[model samples]
Target: MDPDSVSTDNILLPRNIEIIDSKIVNLSIILFISGYISKVEISKFSHFRELYLLYIPYKFKLLLRGSRDGFTPRKFHESCDNVSNTLTFIKVKGTEEIVGGYNPLRWESSSSWGKTNDSFIFSLKNNDINNAIISDIENSTYALNYYSRNGPRFGNDINIENPNSQNENYNRIFCKKHHYKKKIRDSEEDFSIEDYEVFQIIKC
Candidate 1:
């Protein structure tokens, strides 16, 4: 062997894998509601680095009655861009059920809502508050037409303010208002809700 030949063993190489330790994100949606962001427990399965919290006031949530419709508030478009997962957590008013779901898609402001083919909404069923089930993924689009403010105009047949109406009977999760005046069927993807705090899970 020639003494001038360089030894490959002495060559330095870059690391191929960067190990990251799991840590809790300091983001607090509760802060906006209760003026606190820490100690906000979330399901461990919510693997996110950053979270944009949106608090839906109970007064505003009262309008979520009736069928499922797309509902967006004044500042709803503030976080509509980018690819992110929407995690909604609802606390039933008259029951002990704390249920919500995750929509794996970007909230778009386009003509209609743009969604990924892997869209799904899951709920925290009994005996498993942290582990939610994948309710559905067949529909590429879970969120239909979007509407801001009071939603679409309806006839006298529907009483949006009636406490005994289905709207107030079964509190639905925080979602958008639609353009059409029809009942949004509660399927696997469309789960019922009450008072909820929505968060947009984002990666750093």
Candidate 2:
């Protein structure tokens, strides 16, 4: 389906499926056409999308993919720096865990922190959305960290490091509870990632 053609007015639902809310139906169509989410994962992403839409209607556009664009801090900043309202997804290596965060401020290649109350870190359950955990910013002062040597960092809770490392599987990623309300991952140990993606959220 063409993403440009997606709208609440044109979306046709099956007769068997009851339309409870038009916003969710519209969000499902947009998420499906983006191809970043599968049919099974649409519901999970739809809820996340709705939260953003509550303030302003936004469309997610793919900015970077670790496997496709290279998993370096240089590569991440090249495509994502100066872009505001981005959603990042990291697929943990050797596991089904998907951890990510939403940055409402522009990313820069400088050593500084971006403060925002809307930013959040989360872990999406691969099969069940109910088990997913979302951690809101407990300390707004350290909501986001923009470091020249790191990819992305959500407070002191989660960070992607190793700008000097040549190996993609290097143990550079770390997740722990710090400035966030709760931990997204059960373990606070540093881990490698299978792949990661970043999407720019544009107001529609």
Candidate 3:
């Protein structure tokens, strides 16, 4: 069978593979290659999708890639500001951990706090979906922080500090327990990221 010619809609899995939930499985595979970054896997993305609780099917449209687009606050805002319903995926450097947040409100260059109860932060384990951890917003008023000089900040919990140098270590991306219900990362110390991607969630 020609792999490239096989359409996602009618593609068939091996007969030996068990079909527990076909819809979720299919959606996972389709969305994984649909312009989303390579760090997030099918199962992990599927779990993230379930967290949204949207009635209609949605697709992730890549808005910005930190490595490809540049890891600066100015660059982030230029590409992502004004775009609503964005899902960010950050690959932690030197670890199998992938942490991110979902903002239902539009990102802005002006400084302000975005209020929305639908926002959430999460950590996905690369090998297992069951190990994923999701932290819901405890305070809607501080759900998201939009600043002209910083990357995405989820209520001071998961903050991607504006890069000041070319070295990844100076980026200082960190996660701490704050407005969210719980901490997504095991530690509250600052860390660096391998790469990150922001996607606009579009309902179809």
Candidate of highest lDDT? 2
- What is candidate 2's lDDT per residue for 90-145, written digit by digit as tens? 88878777788888799997788999988888776553445667788999999998
lDDT of 2: 0.70
By TM-score, how accurate is candidate 3? 0.72
TM-scores for the candidates: 0.38, 0.72, 0.72
List, residue by residue over 24-142, the lDDT tens digit for candidate 1.
Answer: 11122222221111224443222221121222121111122212333333223343333345544554444444343344554444435444444333333332433433333343443
Runs with alpha carbons beyond 4 Å of true place in candidate 1: 1-72, 79-83, 125-127, 130-132, 141-145, 149-194
Give the per-residue lDDT digits (tens) of candidate 3, residues 1-204.
Answer: 787763344333445533122211233333433323223444444434443223225666788877787778778888899999887878787877878888879998667898998888888665344676778899989888887767877888988765463232226678998899988888888888777888787766
Computed on alpha carbons, the lDDT of every model, listed in order, comes to 0.32, 0.70, 0.69
| Candidate 2 clashing pairs, residues 3+ apart or interchain | none
The alpha-carbon deviation from the true structure for residue 179 of candidate 3, after best TM-score superposition, in angstroms, is 0.4
**Residue pairs of candidate 3 with colliding backbone atoms:** none
State which candidate, 1 or 3, has the greater TM-score. 3
TM-score of 1: 0.38
